[model samples]
Target: MMNDEQKTDKKQRLIRKGKKVQEPVNTQLVVNIFEGFTKDERDLTQAHMGAEYFRVMAWIKEEDEQETIGVRSFRGFHQFNERLVFPLDCSSYKYIYIELIKVHSRRDPATSKGTVVMGRAKIRLPPWTSRGKFTSKFNLVGLNSDRCVEIKGYLNLSMQLHRYLER
Candidate 1:
């Protein structure tokens, strides 16, 4: 995470080869968001009680690359095999913050508000310093008043990091 001072200085550029360049991204982070599994204890507990539409929002910490997946109906496993590629300025980012968003509906009479962010999770970047892949399931976390993390359901995906290559 970058401090306030570093964030304020957007002019900071990295030297690639031997020339100074000003691009927001010096590295690229590839995220393949596949599915979401429920941790329900009872049958149809999480299966039936779902919304009309579902989406996902993810962002890198220091890189500040945020994106949202296309709207899709919630079928079994919250199925959405989306490949999201994010350009990162540096490798300062360590975690990919995930937000399961509930898209708003105007046609539904019961609807009252805009998109709502539901379960959330943090995918830790792999320990590898260079290009590599980390694939697994991560549980959603809830933060309380004490700033504690409580593991919730699961978000299945894969993350890969690659440094910019010269042409």
Candidate 2:
């Protein structure tokens, strides 16, 4: 009969042979939100009357249990060049949801205090792209689905997936 040591060695060999080897993956997702512009200057100006600042929130759509990937605040109505970074794990989630909120200086009678959602945009990860670097532009909308913002606004964004180290 084989000794305990011999049995252990055989078990170890079988375990090693059965286990599938995988390389370590280290990747980062970088997002740059560059600019915001509006054609309806009058409407844009009116909207900014009680606006204190703007806040941007990001999260993964799949595992959205009130958890956020990142949050940023900019103190202006225009020209916000914000940068956000997160770990890149495509298998964990499929899409990233970005929301832009307008923080008012004072509470309006019509609405409650604090921040109000002005618009939102979604970034869909392409399955074919390996490099994972791209630029996109989106239009901002209002609360009412049919009643879009009278202002014709554009939001510029750039997203990249960079590989850092591998083992």
Candidate 3:
């Protein structure tokens, strides 16, 4: 025979078993986006001086959530010392994706939206089994005239995996 307390505990356990309880976020992925490089710069100093504006956007999903840096009018490189933190679940890890876009600055009237993807990069997550930090430059590639992908520039960033020391 079960007592009222035991019955209530059993019922609660059964309810919990029936539902999918997600694990608490015990880790975090920290990323510091530094700068973006451009391959060509002669035109920027000469013909296209101060005529180009670029923005670097980053995200870690196939979803709509994303973060973008403000438009920068520069000749050679784009600098952004932005940091983004993502809470990690124990289920799986996700990659950090980056995109460099050329934003229209009331000059170009070619595309309707006026944003073109100039370069792209994908950075893999740090190993979940280890706690460390990595800082390096990743190549950003784009399609050329014949549609063959080529290295456009580079994106410099640092990433670290931090796990909470649970008591």
Predicted structure with the largest TM-score when compared to the true one: 3
- Per-residue lDDT of candidate 1, residues 1-28 (tens digit): 9887776564343224467664543567
Residue pairs clashing in model 2 are none
RMSD of each: 10.1, 5.9, 5.9
- In model 3, the runs with Cα more than 4 Å from the true position are 1-25, 40-51, 71-73, 105-108, 165-167
Count of clashing pairs, candidate 1: 0
Better candidate number, 2 or 3, judged by TM-score: 3
**Stretch of 10 with least lDDT, candidate 1:** 38-47
Task: Give stretches of model 1 more than 4 Å off.
Answer: 1-25, 38-51, 62-65, 71-76, 105-112, 143-150
In candidate 3, what residue range of length 10 has the lowest lDDT sum?
Answer: 40-49
| Collision count for each candidate, in order | 0, 0, 0
Q: Which candidate leads the pack in lDDT?
A: 3
* Model 3 / residue 49 / CA error / Å: 6.7
Q: What lDDT tens digits, residue by residue, belong to model 3 across residues 8-119?
A: 9998788899687655437877888888786642344544535666777777765634565665746558887888777776637558788888777343457787776778
Q: Which stretches of candidate 2 lie over 4 Å from their true place?
A: 1-22, 38-51, 61-77, 107-112, 126-129, 145-152
